[model samples]
Target: MERTLKLTVAYDGTEFHGFQRQANALTIQQVLEERLAKIFGHPVKVAGAGRTDAGVHAYGQVVSLRTTGSIPTDRIALAARSVLPDAIVVTAAEEVDAAFHARFSAKSKIYYYRLDTGPVPDPFLRNYAWHLADEPDAAAMHAAAQRAVGEHDFSAFRAAGGAPVNPVRTILAASCRRDGPLAEFSFWGTGFLYHMVRNLVGTLVDVGLGRINEEDFAAILASRDRNKAGITAPPQGLYLKQVLY
Candidate 1:
């Protein structure tokens, strides 16, 4: 019997190339599908909601796949645990309607980026947060982030290659805040282009550092030119926090 299953996953991503299956390098999807195929006694193709980049992490990444295996929904996680690595965890599993898809069926996604602005880097956060010796002004970043809280052409924020067919995306909300030496940024959006969040964070950090003001940020958005944006923040600090259905 064919059954569709939805799985909520979390991963460190420190060692993963990305979420998609690659021909050579290791990936989240490849590991997941391989492990699942072992339990199901058949090849299983798992589809992830997002193709997070190398070194990026996830707290609530969602996936779906069709299988003929008889494994009970409650036991899927346990079964997967036996075969999967320590960095990947399947937190929840359940049977869903066949029409469900992990990507196309999603409504929106939330992403978070963290920066360690202390004079000294925290060894514990080496793989989890971006450490900057020079502190950034969180208040200035917050103000600049507000300018992105609406639908706009995000061409200026996208990476050089792999441009999406449409450069437009809706940012439902955006905020930046700091506590002590840690600065966190949150973005809720209908969709995001490749490296959009990281690029925004980089440019916003420039604003925080006084390299660019709010006016320049606004002008960059209006120009829709990638050259006007700042550097792409490293992937270690990025996280796919949640996907809203």
Candidate 2:
């Protein structure tokens, strides 16, 4: 009998092209499916909660797959870990209702973007956080982030390509906090468009740098023009922190 399985995954993502499978590049999904197929001794397909961009990390990414293999559902993670690279790990696995889907069934997600505002970038965090030489005003960034809260058209924050037909999404919470040389931006939303979080962070950073004020940020959202927003922040600083069911 085929059983549906849900997996909670975590990965460094520094060496991956993205979470989706690619014809000519390494990806998180490809690696996971390859290892799963080997364990099951048959072709296996895995679906991810999000197709995280290249260089973006994940702490609680969810995935689902159906298989007829006799391996215990809980042990599947253990078995797959033996063959998977050190950068990737199946943190949790269990059987789920047939109707459950990793992506479609998700209710909300939280993403965190880290920034290094130190004079010199930390070598240990170079691949995990965006490094900025000049420290931005965290209080200003926090105040500006409030403009994104609640439901609204997020076209200003959406990237150029793959624009959604309905550019509306709800932001449950958005805030920025700083600790010495590091600043963390957290975004909780019902759904996010392609590159939305990164663009939001970039614009918020601009506000912190005194390039734009809170009123300007609000105007950008009302304008619904992508050009009015700041540049897209680097993917290395972004992390899929959680996916709520």
Using lDDT as the measure, the top candidate is: 1
Clashing pairs in model 2? none
lDDT of 2 at 155: 94
- How large is the C-alpha RMSD of every model relative to the true structure? 1.1, 1.1
- How many backbone clashes are present in model 1? 0
Candidate 1 lDDT score at position 15: 99
**Per-prediction TM-score, please?**
0.97, 0.97
C-alpha lDDT values of all predictions = 0.94, 0.92
- Candidate 1 at 89: error in angstroms? 0.5
Worst 10 residues of 2 by lDDT: 157-166
Cα shift from native, residue 167, model 1 (Å):
0.7
TM-score of model 2 relative to the true fold?
0.97
Lowest summed lDDT window (length 10), candidate 1: 156-165
| Sequence-dependent TM-score of model 1 | 0.97
Candidate 2 residue spans exceeding 4 A from truth? none
